[model samples]
Target: MPVLRVHLDSDRSTARRVLQLHQEGKIHHESREAAREQVWRRGHTPAGDPTFVGITNGRRHVQLLYDVEVYSDTVL
Candidate 1:
């Protein structure tokens, strides 16, 4: 898969929305180290090692590092 540099969005609101999705269960909470390994599951299974989610993106890293808590993730 082609890597997506999602940190391109500088709007804080957009990042906040992602956090809302996680809280509302619309999205699953993964981790911030996606640039090192696959971080999401495809489809809507919600039953596995990694949680299922929609389109796979680098949001997990951003979410972990910013919206949710203080953390570090490998830069893409």
Candidate 2:
């Protein structure tokens, strides 16, 4: 199966969610750490940089970015 890489600016909760989804058969991978690391590395690079921004209305809010990838069954 093809491996999918997901990028996100998240916390421990988000990481847990990703793992849960994988265990539930909702995703092809077991966790989001690899994807997270990939994003961080890209952000540190020069070309094709990746960044995450947060927005709020009036109240205080926290947001996270999430990237999900689906793989082919042939490779799974």
Candidate 3:
């Protein structure tokens, strides 16, 4: 299974939104810090990979990344 790493800002709303999205079938597995670190340990870059997603909060907005396979209306 793929993994998604989510980093939210101090604002709790953003994190809630991400959780909601995940539960709503808009995203695949939620990424854990440990999991992400493990991937990095294996010498893998997240960019252009179809098995990882990275979500972060920018200076003023939220950013979302989804695996190509999970970028659809169907749930995982």
Best TM-score among the predictions, by candidate number? 3
Measured on C-alpha atoms, candidate 1 has an lDDT of: 0.34
Residue 48, candidate 2: alpha-carbon lDDT: 26
Over 1-76, each residue of candidate 2 has an lDDT whose tens digit, in order, gives 2233334434555545655564565642323344445644544222222222221122333233434332233221
Q: Which stretches of candidate 3 lie over 4 Å from their true place?
A: 1-10, 28-44, 47-76
Q: Tell me the spans in candidate 2 whose CA falls farther than 4 Å from its real position.
A: 1-6, 27-76
Give the per-residue lDDT of model 1 (tens digit) for 1-76.
1232212222345456655676687653333234123322211212123332222345443323322121233233
Candidate 3 C-alpha lDDT tens digits along 1-76: 3343433233446555655766676633343333444445545544434333445556656555434222223232
**CA lDDT, candidate 2, residue 49:** 20
* Backbone clash total, candidate 2: 2
Among the numbered candidates, top lDDT falls to: 3
Instruction: Sort every candidate by TM-score, greatest first.
Output: 3, 2, 1
Every candidate's lDDT: 0.34, 0.38, 0.44
Could you tell me every candidate's TM-score relative to the true structure?
A: 0.27, 0.27, 0.30
| Candidate 1 TM-score versus the reference | 0.27
TM for candidate 2 is: 0.27
